[model samples]
Target: MRIPKLASVFLLMACLVAYLTYVKWHIEGIKPALFKVPYQHSGTESDDDKQTSPDLSSDRFQYGIMFDAGSTGTRIHIFKFLLEENEPPKLSHETFKAIKPGLSAYADDPDKCREGIEELMEVAKGTVPESLWNSTPLVLKATAGLRLLPGEKATQLLDKVREVFEESPFLAKGDSVSIMDGTDEGISAWITVNFLIGELNDSDGATVGMLDLGGGSTQITFSPQDKTIQTSPIDYITSLQMFNRTHTLYSHSYLGLGLMSARLAILGGVEGQPLGGSQELVSPCLSPDFEDRWEHAEVVYTVKGQKAGEPVYESCYNKVEKVLYRKVKKAEEAKEMNFYASSYYYDRAVDIGAIDENIGGVIKVNDYSEAAKKVCNSIVETPQEHPFLCLDLTYISVLLQELGFPKDNVLKLARQINHVETSWALGATFHYIESLSRQQMTEHTGKEDKMAALSAQ
Candidate 1:
């Protein structure tokens, strides 16, 4: 009751300072600690660690898995992408694994296909973080091999793959597993090559064409300088819209024109047809003295070379011409376009030392023809190490010419571009992501419209 006024005022000011200090500690320190506790218990990193660590959210790395089901093999591609807002995603890493004998081999026993699919799924599961398992998309696109199978059998195998996909944690849309149309196969491959080379999105960038040879089909796709729709067959032209631009590409896939299928055809063996009892397929394309058993589509055929008469190249050329002549429509526009030939095209070129396996190289259409003649002529004198080499080389030579590549027209043979396999899977994945984004945008716009209408009301 007898306290001085100055001392009382000092005590009051000191209490106010203490109250403000407590409030600051609660708001800036204790609240952050409480929020951070959950992240620590959730087993994620602390806030400080997250700030320093690699960003794993929407703005950074994402992944997609694609399965390529071909006639000879099933391959899985686990692609890791670096995403930036308003920019195209960049492929950072790719994990590719392949299992042999293809999914089509299990057509009769559809249940057996599950093991291979599950094995490939494990690769995807390992590549993508567990946190993103539910969000990552998984897709399988079967090509000519499955397309050639009986409808009932192909359906059974696809159904089993769908079941396996459903059991996995990844996002599996209803249309994720299906047979890819041959035209789409060509277009997807074109997208992959052009995208990898940075031409797909660039308005002024020059685009190269693609030639992909699989086991049961071969595809040629290119954008013509002159609109092909005016002169080319309507069936050969495909219009694709990408990156806000429409590309009228001359794209076609030749069924039964692939190396293996062509071999059977050249040998006069019909696809899906069994030979007469104990009969052998004799062909001039083989070495005169050679005889062996060849296996295709789970059936064994006795194959032998015909007796030597004229020069090997001359006779072999005649037989190969029968398979190529008038069988594939020639694209006059392809004569002017640069093409990147891959898949079996690369394999065959590398086999005969026409191109380097690692660095890749370019060769003229006549290079194949010359190589064929050399191989064919030599096989008769000295038995060839590979019986099919002569035939394969001849087929490729004649096939290119039939497709309208002149003798001097050059083609680039490569197995990979920018450390990624030159295949359609990458392009298909890009298409899938774009489709998803477009769908999400449409839904978002619809929602916004509804909200705006309500506000106006």
Candidate 2:
């Protein structure tokens, strides 16, 4: 809303002042290149995990809504920020909710995606106060799952979401609903890790690397040590600007190298194309005579194992090697960085008692190998709780080695840092809000100048 002449100048000044305050809150973290998920949810909780709200007034707070549309499921994050202070904004309260059968599930029936999208919106409406609904930005970012779909199908799905977003009370930008680029995904994940670790606030502190294993893709990102950098591919290096400082990060996302996709490949089944009929997919990765059913990318396959003979770990390793060999680029620099691995890495580590679910733990590269050997050995004697456990452990060990991490090198794995869950969404929120602020300033300048001239006359 604009006021007459003199008032417009004051409004412009106000916008400028507001933008300056937000800069100290946002620029300390991620920049927009600048960048997807499993659905996990809980009720409203403060920074202390209690139901109590801060003493801040409603007008003094800002909120952001992010929908992580992943292959396996969809999740919504409603975040509230305390913005009245001159210092960096504190994440005061958050509400999260998730639903299965991601948007990609309705590829053929795109419009059917409405029910789920609207359901998530209901959560946002309840979490974000109505007064701030129009000010809060709503965004949905699809990841590898959507990218793997046919061009026309992906476009259709995104269009369907755009329609829902348009009707919501929250602010929606032109690119609000779309498939996120893989490279940006890695960079954003890297930002999430550093931000959570407080590395972004300390200009001179060393930051960490990030390893994210999703159902459709995997990403690796970090700031490489100058001398440790090798002849990496040109596309693997990208420059990021934060706090007005340039950071050249080693980053990449392998579309098909994710744990789920790799498992599907190891089982000898194609992604969209299932075995034409009753043909069962067989592999040495499973226990001898082991028979089971598994579903991937909406296709169900009958999978089993080879006859028991050689050591189970060795047999599984052979299969895992073929799936990963020469596929992952080795980064010598990753070994020197303190890497934080999450997603399936954290899940599998918990499954094997290597890490506690709540606190997580540290492990050397060989820890995977040891876990794989132990698990694989027992699976041969009896039916294991998780049939894919052997293959997963073996695959992770080999994949790490392929990426140039030696057996002795250590990595810290976690699902969260402090009380808040670790995720790329936090980093992305800052980027989105900052972009929105810049757009407003640009639009404000011309209008303000025109009004100032009219006032003088």
Candidate 3:
């Protein structure tokens, strides 16, 4: 049947709109064509992303939200731009808010999903920049905690989170909720950290290795050059597959190193070891109440000697902070302590009992010496590498020599990493501008344009 070209075009447009509406309401939260798909950029932006983006300069938003869901807590970094006359771009203004209700808190309670967003908002109270209050572009995201939700649960949780975002009062016109899984979380962290530390080698390079230590799980990503790993369970949009031509990246999420795991590991190991018979030689790090088990109350104890186990538990207001400082001060000794000994081996002083100045008497040190000694020995025999290492400009030069990478290639990699660092701050600004441009088009014409106008002032 002969049909007018206008009529046929109209029919096609109607079909397209119907499909889009169906996608938006019934299937996924948003259409892949209109929104960034989950895991789509798992390794890096796809060909379509590159093809669609035309303008990469001059954005409109002033503030950006960078959410980092760590092992013990979830941190939200709010950043704002400051315009200066003929000045180089920089992350001039920023703030951070964190919530301790980590992934474990929402493991069973689906309602707790919104807690992540709420916590960030509550903490930002008066701190939110005045400019961002009405039109700020909030980038909502998740990390290790929600990365591994089972099956459709992640989708439902993400949907619920989106629903909360729509209902949230803090949301601005262009605010968005992007739920991410382990791969994306780990990669983004790697990218963000290296960008901050000046490690990304180049604008077109690709590198991947991650060791992320989260609360319940550790995510390890090994994105080989020109290859992608299929570990992420979420659709492509939720994954953070980074693809660059000239950068170096490695990341991993180790689950057991968080505060909770570390404490448990220490406690369990200490339980098996027997204390020594020494009195007044107690370890200074342990508290007198080390042996007590109260489900809800704080444990208290005192260490007995100098360099000996002191009443560390009783002296500190919080056990975590005390342990953190102790850990850093003792980090050099980490290689000597095994996972088992890490629980109780503060020092040999703990083997000796503490002195009771009030009673003029010496206390006995119940030494778990043998067990601690065993664990310490293991640490020495097997050293743990840094969770992830950066192949910075200098590192790349050295690594290339060791691997016999052509001198030319070495120089190229070095140059790329240097360039990325130089442009790191601007890259983020460009990304934000691009996002704003797309949103404006969608709002006005119902046409989602991938290209965004971004420029530096």
Measured with C-alpha atoms, the lDDT of residue 41 in candidate 2 is: 34
Name model 2 segments beyond 4 Å from true.
1-42, 45-59, 84-87, 227-230, 243-245, 442-457
The per-model lDDT (C-alpha) reads: 0.80, 0.79, 0.36
Worst 10 residues of 1 by lDDT: 30-39
Worst 10 residues of 2 by lDDT: 30-39
lDDT of predicted model 2 = 0.79
lDDT of 3 by residue, 9-118 (tens): 78777766675575345322111111111111212234564465443232322455555544356666665443222222233334556678654356566677676767
Quote model 1's TM-score: 0.84
State which candidate, 1 or 2, has the greater TM-score: 1
Q: Which segments of candidate 1 are over 4 A away from where they belong?
A: 1-58, 452-457
- lDDT for each residue of candidate 2 in 126-201, tens digit (9 for 90 to 100): 7888999999999999986788789999999999899999999999989888788877787887877786677865
- Clashing residue pairs in candidate 2 are 35-184
Q: Report the lDDT of model 1 for residue 78.
A: 82
Q: Which candidate, 2 or 3, has the higher lDDT?
A: 2
Candidate 3 vs. true structure, TM-score:
0.39
